[model samples]
Target: MATANGKLLTVPEVLAELGGEVARSTFYEWRAKNQAPKCIKLPNGEIRVRRSEFDRWLESRTEEAA
Candidate 1:
């Protein structure tokens, strides 16, 4: 999990960062499997992901072309 002090992105923002191709349901599924970037749940149950952590996560999933 990342620190909360960093910029926090909402689920929609995250999706847009992913090019607006991934559905919300699919993202939720990734969370359930713990395959997505670490997220923070606020007191009001809103989900947020740190910008740095999200960038790291995207890098982790990248595959170099052969």
Candidate 2:
């Protein structure tokens, strides 16, 4: 399900949003490690992340580096 802000993003979309700085395998690794952004598993078994959550997660990472 998409948030009011925008549509839910796929793994590839999330990668593009991050400018492809991280490889797909690495992203999946992070997800497995619970270090990635929040995601939702649809009934169809598809994974998606809300744009707002992704943005928030990115901001948190930036703050962590500060």
Candidate 3:
């Protein structure tokens, strides 16, 4: 669940709050397509996406449609 400020969100947290519309596999698909969100890759290979960058990406989609 998101906090009131939404300072951080995990992958599942994002998918769950969005009603499971995008599956975990889709993240991989986007990566394969070179369209995944800006991700930080840890030395152990874990990925952490920044909420602000993601929101910017989301907002750009809206601007494109305008």
Candidate 4:
């Protein structure tokens, strides 16, 4: 299920978008370390990442080959 533009993405959706390159545990680890993209914590305690922010974060990760 593709996330619509500007929609908020769940952990699983973000993982799928990364092609499963990173494990779910690693994602959580990143969150804990504040290394992942900014996320929203819903009132119920669920975490969500905005599509636009995720896209920006992903783009920022791009590094020119040495």
Candidate 5:
């Protein structure tokens, strides 16, 4: 489903869409450690990570790795 601004992505989807090979469980682990991107928890208990936020996170990681 598209968000208010036409974004349609989940955490794993965002990671894959960005060409990140992170595993689903690993992503959850990162989230547990507060090391993942910013996110929103909906009333249905679903986690949603914004595409823009993930992009920024990926860019930051790339810069850090450089």
Candidate 6:
């Protein structure tokens, strides 16, 4: 569904897009620490990660190789 942040991604989709190395528990741990992309908690209790926010978060973590 399109949110204010545009397309929303499920946690599984996000993990798969990240190459399937990150576990749900790990992602949740990062979320609790405010280290993962910003998420939306729906009425049913499922979480959604905004595509734009995730993109921006990925950009912020980019490193320049020396």
Best of the candidates, TM-score = 6
lDDT of 3 by residue, 1-66 (tens): 233544555667556755889898997688779676666666787665667757766676664434
Q: What is the lDDT of residue 23 in candidate 1?
A: 98
Give the RMSD in angstroms, all C-alphas superposed, for model 2: 2.3
In model 6, the worst 10-residue window by lDDT is: 1-10
Q: What is the alpha-carbon lDDT for the whole of candidate 4? A: 0.89
Give the runs in model 5 whose Cα sits over 4 Å from its true position: 4-8, 18-20, 64-66
Against the correct fold, how does model 5 do in TM-score? 0.73
RMSD of each: 2.8, 2.3, 4.4, 2.8, 2.5, 1.0
Clash number for each model: 0, 0, 0, 0, 0, 0
Between candidates 4 and 5, the one scoring higher on lDDT is 4
Q: Report clash pairs, candidate 5.
A: none
For model 2 the TM-score comes to 0.81
Model 5: lowest-lDDT 10 consecutive positions: 57-66
After superposition, the stretches of candidate 2 with alpha carbons farther than 4 Å from their true spots are 63-66
**TM-score, per-candidate, Cα-based:** 0.90, 0.81, 0.66, 0.86, 0.73, 0.93
User: Candidate 3: deviation at residue 63, Å?
Assistant: 5.8
lDDT of 6 by residue, 20-39 (tens): 99999999999999999999
Top-lDDT candidate index: 6
Model 3 reaches what TM-score against the true structure?
A: 0.66
Q: Which of the two candidates, 3 or 6, achieves a greater lDDT against the reference? A: 6
What are the lDDT scores of the predictions, listed in order?
0.92, 0.88, 0.66, 0.89, 0.76, 0.93
In the range 7-65, model 1's lDDT, one tens digit per residue, is 88999999999999999999999999999899989999999999998999999999999
Q: List residue ranges in candidate 6 displaced over 4 A.
A: none
Q: Which whole-number lDDT from 0 to 100 does residue 38 have in model 6? A: 93
User: What TM value does model 1 have?
Assistant: 0.90
Per lDDT, what order, best first? 6, 1, 4, 2, 5, 3
